[model samples]
Target: MSIALAAISILHLLDLVILITSTAANAWIVDGDLSADLWYKCTSKNGGYHCKQSINEDWLQAVQALMVLAVLFCLLSFVFFLCQLFTLVKGGRFYFTAVFQILASLFVMSGAIIFTVMNYAAASSSYGYAYVLAWLAFPLTLGSGLIYIILRKTE
Candidate 1:
């Protein structure tokens, strides 16, 4: 049980880190010298990089909001998990933590799907590591959430 608890904690932390990195990274899509992220679009030219704010598109804005919300929920879930670990009764389950984590996964999945669908026409460019990270976070969060649901406060 101790080993399982530690593993879950590690997974939750990893998910949070990946969420933060994916949200902050400026490489959701890359094409030659150009790269774009939720916040900005950057281009490399003449041995320098020029960055500009991302376009004011409704979908992009939605993605940004969802990603931020996901990170926040993940953080909240982790905190709640720690609190419940100590305060919860021996037989009680981590329902609150599980719900928050599941919500976070949903948010991540929604944001990534929106980005993929909106950018489908831009086949010339390739999806970057940040984009992949966003996708990767979805399943990990969901799995952790399910695990939390099954976990009980055991002595």
Candidate 2:
């Protein structure tokens, strides 16, 4: 059993978990940021922020649902990766497994970048480390992905 292969799988799992957490956390961040703005804007007049205590329940719920689904997908992806990794250990080329793994990383990086851009000013209020891990993880994820592709069996 190649230790490096298992390590790669573990790293993939870790990235998957991070993606799930990032998704779920994004919902809270969005709600919190919006809620805080609403709170202050309610007190401060003159069209400063235009926030209200009674925010859009539908939008909030929708975002929450999206977060749940995103997390679920990430979890499922990890599970599938584990199964695939076990099979690859026995005798299998890193095929779709690597592709999916890379895709997951891409998803999270894109999500992080998008969130950072969307909440650019949130730093003043909250929304910390918008592009922190994504920036670092992107290249690592991409490099690992390329390694997997090159290591894959041609047959």
Candidate 3:
């Protein structure tokens, strides 16, 4: 593959890795002895730790759904990129892949924003690595999408 395509592939892969890791981790917020994620809230109790299902808030559910959608869209975009790379004409652009990736970026951004806004009113806790990673993935996904849109198929 050409260097440009390889570079774009690597970037897309990196964004996907970040998205998956952030979504699955249990560290969106960390308090003194408690941590919360999309799925669960864990607390240190009696020298041990206990986990419970996250509160059933509509916004929280939306954030969870959006994050999952972002991961799926990113994965679909990668698959589309591979297929287009093999079959697309030399001058054709990866519009399909670009659209999917752009949507992925938007979904991730929306999820993160909602989480940040909703959590601001909750008990005091600092954002954790997973939260930071979700924000980090947004720009990477956006850049990858723009690259796809600008890139042309090459020999």
Candidate 4:
């Protein structure tokens, strides 16, 4: 039981880390020497790199907000899990934590889907690390949330 609990906690932490990194890293699209992310587009100029605000689009803004919300909800879920772990009686389910985590997963999925459908500028460029990471975090978070939903406190 202890080992399983520790593993779940670790997976949750990993999902949180991936969510943060994916949302913040500037690599959503990669072109020859240019890259773009949620917040900025960076291009390599003669011996240097220049970064500017990302394209102003409604969908892009929606993706940005969703990613941020996902990260926040994920963090909150973990905190709730810790609090519940100590306060809940044996056999109590971590429903609050599971809900938050599941919502986080949904937010991530929504953001990624929006990007996939709306990102026109990047049609020529290849998807970058941040894009891949966002997709990766989605399943991990969902799995963690499902694990929490089915898990019960045990001595």
Candidate 5:
């Protein structure tokens, strides 16, 4: 039980880290010296990088909001999990944590999907590691949620 608890905690922490990285990284799309993210568009020039605020597109804004929400929900879920771990009755499942985590996963999926569909028409660049990390976080968060649902508090 202790091992499972520790593993679940680790998974949740990992998901949170991935979510933060994907949201903040300036490499959602990359082509040669050009890279773009939710917040900025950057290009390598001479020996330095030039960056500017991202264009205000509805879809891009939606993606940005969704990603931020995903991070918030994941953080909230972790807090709830810790609180529940100590106060929840034996055999009580981590339903609140699971629900928040599942919502976080959905937000990540929505953001990634929106970015993929909308960005397809905007640029011919390849998706970068940050984009891949967003997709990766979706499944990990979902799996973590499912695990939480199945996990019961035990002495």
Candidate 6:
């Protein structure tokens, strides 16, 4: 259980890094200059769609901040799980940890979905494979939450 949760934590951190990089192109305080833009363009091509974007710097930053908070919440939930693993009985309040995780995952997913939809609405643009990883994250997170529920009440 610990190993599984640890792996999940690591994956969550990695996803956060990717999410941050994806936003780098339009950071208000860290403008995605020409070189950075080119990098995004190149990497994006590998992902099955044009990854390059022209987002409003402030909007991009705002989105990043929101997602970061979501990730932090996930981390917090994991921390709670860790505490319970060490101190609680097998089934004591596991549901609470799972509930927090589920809520956090839902928030992150909604944010990502909203961001994608808004991006399309703003520019009528399409996203490609780079988004696959993000899309993949949603289910993984949800799965984790479900795992907690399954494990709950187990002797």
lDDT string, candidate 1, 23-141, tens digits: 99998999999999999999999999999998999999999999999999999999999999999999999999999999999999999999998875466899999999999999999
Off by over 4 Å in 6: 1-62, 121-130, 153-155
TM-score of 4: 0.97
* Candidate order by decreasing TM-score: 4, 1, 5, 3, 6, 2
lDDT head-to-head 2 vs 5, winner: 5
TM-score of every candidate:
0.97, 0.53, 0.95, 0.97, 0.97, 0.58
What are the RMSDs of all candidates, in order? Answer: 0.9, 7.5, 1.4, 0.9, 1.1, 7.3
* Candidate 4 positional error at 80, Å: 0.2
Segments in model 1 whose C-alpha atoms lie over 4 Å from true places: none
C-alpha positional error of residue 151 in candidate 5 after TM-score superposition, expressed in Å: 0.3
Task: Give the range where candidate 1 is weakest over 10 consecutive residues by summed lDDT.
Answer: 116-125
Scored by lDDT, model 3 comes in at: 0.94
Tens digits of per-residue lDDT, candidate 5, 1-155, equal 88899999999999999999999999899988989999999999999999999999999999999999999999999999999999999899999999999999999999999999888534567889999999999999999999999999999
Candidate 5 local distance difference test against the native: 0.95
Over the stretch 18-129, how does candidate 6's per-residue lDDT look in tens digits?
5444334332122122222212332323335334544556544555565666566667767776777677775665676677667766765766666665553323334443
**Count of clashing residue pairs in every prediction:** 0, 0, 0, 0, 0, 0
lDDT of 2 at 147: 58
lDDT string for model 2 (29-124, tens) is 333324332112233345454544434445434433443444455455556655665566534566665575566556555555544444434543
- Model 5 TM-score is 0.97
